[model samples]
Target: MASTPGILTHWPWEPLGNFKYVLVAPFAVHSLYLFAVGAEDWNLTYLLTFPFMLWRMIHNQLWISYSRYRTAKGNNLIVDRSIDFEQVDRERNWDDQILLMGILFYAVHWGVDVVAKIPFWRADGLLLTFLIHIGPVEFLYYWFHRALHHHYLYSRYHSHHHSSIVTEPITSVIHPFGEHIVYFILFAIPMVITALITRTGSIVSVSIYVTYIDLMNNMGHCNFEVIPKWAFTVFPPLKYLMYTPSFHSLHHTQFRTNYSLFMPFYDYIYGTMDKSTDTLYETSLKKPEDVPEAVHLTHLTTPESVYQLRLGFAGLASKPLTSKWYLWLMWPVTLWSMISAWIYGRTFIIERNTFKKIKAQSWVVPRYRIHYRLQWQREAINKLIEEAILEAEEKGIKVMSLGLLNQGEHFNRNGEIYLERHPKLKMKVIDGSSLAVAVVLNSIPVGTSQVLFRGCLSKVAYSVVSALCHKGIQVTSIKKAEYEKLKKSLTTQDSSNLALSEKGYNQKVWLVGEDLTEIEQSKASKGTIMIPFSQFPPKKTRKDCFYLNTPSLVAPKSFGNLHACENWLPRRVISAWRVAGIVHALEGWNVHECGDRVFDVDKIWEASLQHGFRPSGLIPA
Candidate 1:
């Protein structure tokens, strides 16, 4: 919002909230209705309008993903600032401007007969659109933008946009309702005149022009220096006509300068261009990628998990990620990501964070769980993990923790293969089993005498069950084989409390893992709590039951600038596996906890607590 809210401060359809699109639905349907009933060839003009609007939306989304991917690399970043949840929430309404444009366009098409009669092609009108845009549209927008920077208008309107000092591509369109109305009028000038005076406008020309605007708008705010200096040198005057992301970035940093829209001609002529634009651009382009002291190596889960990445949508990434109905519409991009990952066949940095003096990064292996499950693909998956470890070691990373399926006991003996292969390596490899055990054991509510342990058992489960039985808490298992297998690992005193029976149905607490059956879950009473020892969470089977999150703890305030969640965990709450790597790096630990090696869960829990990572109670709701 602005410093002092003004008239028409909100969109007329603001009350509709997420349903604001309903306002444009009728016009969209009417456009389709005309096409469906076999209207005249020229009447198809209205039908094309809706698809053009949709294309604009897809164009903005691509710019968003591309900008995030580039900036996450840490090189060529224009600003050394962060984007928090507040900025994401503020900019989420970027599509509202597109919705407003749709309304105004449908109104014009309905009122003007000439718009309906416009032909499929008009060479003269396209030429006029170019001339008129450079003449009236660009020049007028320059002054209009300048006027908005005046204290009064700036406080009431433009301040909302400057809220994001470190801009994303969508920041170009995040303006108040009144500001968008004026911008719509300025952009409409070329088309309106092309229709009224020359009467030679076509849907193709209009689409081409709007697409040009979207391209320039998205490009200007990417917060990276993609436009190379060589381009300006190759064609000198192009610099005068076009602007780079770093050029516009200066305006946000040092306000009251570089007020031109897409072209910098007006800024130069009016002497409003920032002097440091070129220097900033050159330096940003030359900046190096950051080197982290610790790296958490993990793999992708379900295909929908792609959007849950910090590089994806901010709102979705900031919360505990779950499958959404609308994600089905993003299948094209999902399929592309899968194909690209398969072809690229290597790890890529997706997230970055700071822990005091230590820099940490989360690198993804690009392969999903199903890929690792295939007998033929295990070797390839191991190869990817091996490459990532070598790369981290070469970069002087002190610690690397294998997370999720990347550390499967069957595949690599919990990341033990890398250690055996590289005997004298300085970097320590850990599977974080100690922390996982600590989080799970501490998470069980106090005074709970018995817990029904279900699902596939693993090393972490064995450690947790032993500790539980020793604590005088009764441990019960429904599977007799699992019970006997666990009993063999425990001393007689501890094993005395471990029981095997079909008594699981009467228990209120359950410690679950992979392949937990639906029938087993269905037998549990309502309001039962399901705690998972595995990195992957169980599917929510009963609405009444409580499903705790995977092992994770809340990050400290010192670990600032976190704008996204870790897998299914909420914002700033990191997985224990990831925290273990950082703690190991920070404390200068030189031990490996994998294969037959053991960890003191009590010691790890104490060390992590001392580092300010508080144990987060795992209830999602």
Candidate 2:
């Protein structure tokens, strides 16, 4: 364990394993003095140490990137790599970094006195200067970082930093220029004030402090566990004093904790240290072979993003010319959604759970599905949905499914709207409607030619009817106009005898159209069975009637639940959940938990597995 030079020599690169962090700040200060000021003054210390620090930074970055790629420990990474690289356009981030550096350092005309040439070694003065920088800077930064987490500030400023959960070297410096100005003012002002007040100020010391800060920032974002475990095991107190890549990574993944910059002392004092910080850090340090076969990374929007999106939604909904007056009237409802998001929409992670060889890690946005729908504000619903997909994609979610409402035919044509609108959203946006249709169709017995269609006019119901007819069932319908619409609409490829019949029906009935009571009243013969889409059966409904809705709507007795007809949701939800669960497990990708919270993939999987019954629909069509 001790003999490996690469492991021991690069111990600071490891997460939670480096105990010698105090030296890092001072060392960085010294190195910058050597590189930037070396040519001007020939000092023995400068000549010896300058080249090493410069090479160390570049070498560490290269080694970390190489190790992560070779080990393929992507699942264990705090974030997806694609987010750090692909999503953050290289040119833009580089431009931002270059601009900030040029303006802050080169572009500004600093007087010669700003960087002191005299190198004086004063042990007490050096220690005091380090303390001055650490104390006030940490104090001010804690508040500043916390302030940025606020809803409005996050969207406008801090969002750019949090954009890459799978952080990189550049991620350390990719702050919004506006945020940079503020951060610069906060950090520099305190150091400058401390330096002047102490009367031990030197350009060399100040440069060292700044260099120390930049080094720590890069180390915290390194995304590699270079620290050895022995450090923490040997001296437990070090955990509170030093920040690791895992510490900052936690801030990115779970934003509510570890906000302090260099040290976690403030985080502990404020009672904000994440409960799982130690455990998560340990988990991250595990070698690839030690972890599960598959690890999933989930993406969620910050509270600020939700608030911003909701406000945007309200604006779009309130657009007088573009939207319906009633939609405009729903401004209160839209505003209420924003409030709900504030109350409930905190970013969260579902602990990684494994099912056999596959692991499922779900990242959940706090906002409800209704927020994305814009609360009936149709004008902005599409845009909001597109933004949601883009957010997920930016977070590196490989596969995402939207709510049934968001992905319905009204909003999308076989996912074409999402595909066309967001060419950059490379992830799959599955509606699960195809699987839902398969499950719905499977509930019906095959080889039955004469079938009565109830909701033939509705697009979803029509699709079902068309599918049944294609499967060789002679589908009969009651809506004269809808039946004519289907007849005229069917192409040669979809040709089927979807008949309009007022005749007495003795065969099984597929209830999909509106006016369930009217259809029941108009039935010539007592149908063998009524397969309802969602609407509850009439009081006169026969005992054999079956409800075939996927994730069938639960109508409790308080809501006037009927006893005579059978609701298939009881049986249907199990199959649908299992299939989706298996898919999530097998693929280890993001599963969009849409619509009703009760029908989420997790709940469905638990219920389905407990029931221990596989419905016919598990097989994909």
Candidate 3:
């Protein structure tokens, strides 16, 4: 089995690593200088740092993209290249949109600032303004930042940021443009509103605050740690009141706590801060559990049953298992046995419930046996099933199917049953013993989902499960024997001396009807046209094929005129009628009128090719 990617690893102790110290030092020095001298100039700061920030952000994205490409190309790297760039780009665009919106707001603020010409407000006549602004600005920043992580939006947007579990400086600003815009707007809003309303605006103070935030953000994402051990103890409840690298690191590591960035006060007040900060480092130092309880339970049993077993065991072991007498050994033995029995009983219950659920969901539909000897035909069947499921979902119908037994159950243990019971999904198992039945049942349009898995159930079961899952159907697994029988039937022929390859026999057929103009045909053939058909065309196309302009008389006659053209046309066609595109089109024009009872062109062509059907100029070499 492939090892889980390191990017998924969660370590708590040394969260921000060395970067935290690096960020704090510069920030502290700059802040002190500003405080002591009351410096007014910010141009030097912006000129020196903004370009670096932009460069770091771009460099990080390029590295990530390159890493992904290399991994896909089969190169080894420090990190797994499973990051989805398309998703990242989408998220980044959203962030950019938000950022642009924020810039607009900033423009409005600029106008207000000029019109009001507010005097700078300070706590100590001049300094108090800076402190007061920092507090509320940081507070608002934390609140909006926390809101972004809410479940409603995390999967689609914030997940991209979390994709880089191991933070790098570049990854810090790689948020979707929308999120960046929102952050900018929120960060500026407090300061802008205060300055406008109170007639006290300090460019120097706001610039300091923004610079501090930027440094802090970079430090939080820095892969190194810089904060000294003594600072936690010496800085007046620093560990509890102020944000540190470790605190921010915890936010990424756990993903559910430590939302505050500049301070821990808000998180503590809201009861969102994890109380195990000191223990986090210890936990990281300890050897990882050989078998995490969650993983084991998901693989072996349902959570409900696991919980019940624990409850029963606690009930049984409450008294002293070992006492200072003969009762000591006897009581301990009794308690252990009771606990074991409870565990065993719980497993049995889980298995039983699983089976019951499978049985309850089973239904039969009319199915046609797919000749599996033909690979293309089989693919056609799979494609049809995929489209049908999508169509059903669009029409508000729930399609259900059995999943791969072992893995399906494993996922269930992981608390991922939404796939099984999505609004447009459901699944049931056929008797576990009959793979043939399962496969046959799958082809029928029984619910809105029009596919099933039967033969070679154990071998192809996972494929079927994945396919159905991709189409949003819940799947379950049936018995092995049934799948085996189905497989044998699919491979065997009733006629003698008819040994067919699986791909040749099992290939599926699709009837595509299109009213193609000459340009449309050319474009479609070039794969540039997006037709109304639910199915997209495969990347490869038949070579040397000529377009036939024959009128197809297929019923449900919405398909205007059908055209049939063939590649590898014979060289010695004696007449003009035979070579003419119009005549050739007319030859097979009426085939579509037969509905689903059409002849197998691929099989017929294969037979003809074997029997010496030769083309002069059209043969694809």
- What are the root-mean-square deviations of the candidates from the true structure over C-alphas? 2.6, 20.5, 26.2
Report the C-alpha lDDT of model 3 over 94-152, residue by residue, as the tens digit. 22322243234334543553422433334332354456545776688778777767775
User: Scored by CA lDDT, what does every candidate get?
Assistant: 0.86, 0.49, 0.34
Q: Which candidate is the best by lDDT?
A: 1
Cα lDDT of model 1 overall? 0.86
> Which sections of candidate 2 miss by over 4 Å?
1-85, 90-103, 106-109, 112-125, 190-199, 202-204, 290-621
lDDT of 2 by residue, 1-621 (tens): 111112112222234322223334454465466677656544433333434344444444453334333224334454433331122342123223323332343222233333233244444455676775568778898988999788767766676667776665546766655666666776665445434455555445645665676667767876665556789899998887788877888898888799998889999999988888777677767745223222222222322222122112222211211223445445775567567654652333322333444433333344443454454655455555566566656665455544334454544553457676655554655554433444446557666666776652434455566677666667776668767777675665555667777664665545443346644644534435445442222233443344444433222122110111111223112223224433443454443432211123334434433433345322110
| Clashes, model 3 | 69
Q: Order the candidates by lDDT, highest first.
A: 1, 2, 3
The clash count of every prediction, one per candidate, is 0, 13, 69
Model 3: lDDT equals 0.34
Score residue 254 of candidate 1 by CA lDDT. Answer: 92
Better of 1 and 3 by TM-score: 1
